[model samples]
Target: MSTNNYPFQLGQDQSRRKFIYNFTKAAGVATLLTSPVISHADSFFVPPAPVTVGEVMDMFINQVPGAPFNSTVDTLKAGNRDIQVTGIVTTMFATIEVIRKSIALGANFIIAHEPTFYNHQDQTAWLANDEVYRYKADLLQQHNIAVWRNHDYIHSINPDGVRMGLLKQLGWQSYYNPVATNVLMLPTTSLSSLIDHLKQKLFIDKVRYIGDLKQNCQKILLMPGAAGGTRQIQAMGKEKPDVLICGEIQEWETAEYVRDAQAKGQKLSLIVLGHIASEEPGSEFMANWLKEKLPGMKITHLLSNNSLSFL
Candidate 1:
């Protein structure tokens, strides 16, 4: 073979022994086999690009339609946005236990679905002197963990990310109404059985409901998280669902409406799934989404369990 065809030039005068020794020692058999010249490779393996907290936030913002809203509660609650994220944890809330777990997992970014402080806007000025607030804040600061609320943006998605997740968990995709994502035309079943189904799927020991056990149910209106009493009632009125499954409800509001509607011989009902339990699946969905979007990055979903327990 002509030496010109080879990547390296070989001299005829060189002994076969000397040629083999030079090739093995200088080029190395392994290197020659793996090298781009001999292997005809386009590129070598490279690690996934290092991602920052802000970049991941931007990915969500960019994907969400009508994002960069005029005002949003989806703000970073702790740590610097510029910090390089070692790992990510998505949760319903950044509770003390969740924060500790994130730290233990070596995750520096926490994408939470609700307020970190006790209120909607996460106003810390009022909580400045509060002991619990101070402790939670200090813990995040100590471990350099960043908590970002993803409330508005996640809900702003067309089908609503939280609702999509909940529907997926319920195995009701076939029953979902695309035009009215919250509405589901389930196969006719008793209200009690529906509640049982929800409890089983949601892994909840019990659920608070306002309806007779034997009442037949077909239409369902699922409003996860605290969509407020007025919104829930209005949806109930408009959709005229046989049952309204929601996160949390004030005793004097939607629950009362359901009671009165039932009194009037209306086929109406309500099931409260608690706020944390209702939205935790959405956080899990978010983590799963990020796993696909940023392959090779560590993303985990941890539940921020409900504080209430039956006596």
Candidate 2:
């Protein structure tokens, strides 16, 4: 959607004009506003009063360069990028339920930290002919919703948005290092007790562990949202952390390595908090940033339904 066909009337009054001007300035796209307001006949391609989808996407990527995922501006389907996004909604995953919630909040632009379509890449290859995928994609088209993934951008930002959220939620901001996105020191506690505390505090059900709870955990390495491969796992071991709190891990890789450490009698622990729970905080941070950047625009946050059910 371009500036010409903006949905909201920008030339109504002085206040409206000021609002648009300030919003464009905050978005760092004031140069695009040569004309006070522009309109287009393509109702499907509604642009936000003062901002464009490209600008919004650019703002997010530029602000959060360290995000873990990638985004694509594709025109594969009709009405995909035709929406004029007034407000922005941030979420871990842009599932159907989340999309519905965004629409109810009057936010047509969605900035998702994870994939909208099920996979990590948000690709629709397998769903190219799938009935359910097609229906979901069509629903988005009908509503004129424009979805963008801000994963990689957020991760690339110094300190990493996800890690920052985790630290904020844990009240460990003082311990966090902005340059390395690592914690200097955490309160000393038993591995088991720390696990229990995290479960109770986060109110999460799927917290899994891979160490002797009785061990005293003086130092812990935390990597939210998926453990790295064997090489990185080995490096983490060198750090001599009593425990490693990671979001998720492949069953055969980090998970098994932790088991091996246990077998070898190393007093190391691994806590798996699932990917969604690990990354949820970042979306909340995104919402706060949106509020700061676009003061006039209404902002809302939608959370993904828990994707895993354990026996």
Candidate 3:
């Protein structure tokens, strides 16, 4: 890719403000107001306004207009209510570490990008009798923490909150193609050089690779979190990108397909940035977003420890 070929141009200060304004307006109040409610026994417990979980969720969906909520394992945790949520914390997953962080920050409500429970759907029915699950559940109950998931919602949101956050962190805001978030035309650089740059820029340690690093390709397709199905595969074939930057892949599916493609002499390479690494930036963006939405509420973002180790 030519240096001149980089598609985005950073806007001036005024332009950036306008961009933020437009982006927020486009996102709408629904995404901004989808916070958890709180209840208190004392006069101090009363919020300025009472809001329900469903109502906040609806608002979030409306604002984003494209978040995916159907596959969400559970919408609201077992015990949650509509009161004024005092503070909010956005996290990739509500692990033991995350819960502790939320409490330390004085955040009572958690908006998770992934599942609170282990599974994608976050079903705990089978774990009812399981000791480990019981222990985790009991901890939340003791803490008075309310958890709501925003998996599909963030994915479906326009510009994709996660992807947007990653791009912003990389200072690649102007490089996005006007046509789509996945398609980005960046300045000319070798694959290895780009990888090194990403490591430092993203501050990550577990980036996996599938394909030759020596290959030079300008147009890159970034499918963060996880790569999709056969249709997406076919589309990638058509695009014939130099590289596909993704969060993670199923070894039997996307990884296998990429291997086959390489054997067939395709020049494409797949860079597997860990799922959490790929999605964490978006969580950071969510913190900023929540701060804007609930100005009075304290918001913080917590990152998951990277899951991969190189031998």
Residue-level lDDT tens digits of model 3 in 1-311: 32322223322222232112111111112222232564433232222244454555566677766344455553776348663465566777888777877777766777888877788778889888988788878877787778888777776777778889889866778888757668888776667766765665567655778865666758888887865656447658777788888877777777788888889988878787778877878877877876565544455677655645777
lDDT of 2 by residue, 54-171 (tens): 6666666665534323444321222344455667777877788877777777677888777667776566888899988998898788788888777666766776887887777655
TM-score of each: 0.85, 0.77, 0.78
Q: How many pairs of residues collide in each model? A: 0, 20, 7
Between prediction 2 and prediction 3, the one with superior TM-score is: 3
Error of 1 at 225 (Å): 0.9
**Given candidate 3, what's the lDDT at residue 209?**
82
lDDT of each: 0.80, 0.66, 0.68
For residue 302, model 1's alpha carbon misses the true position, in angstroms, by 0.4
Candidate order (lDDT): 1, 3, 2
Quality of model 3 by C-alpha lDDT: 0.68
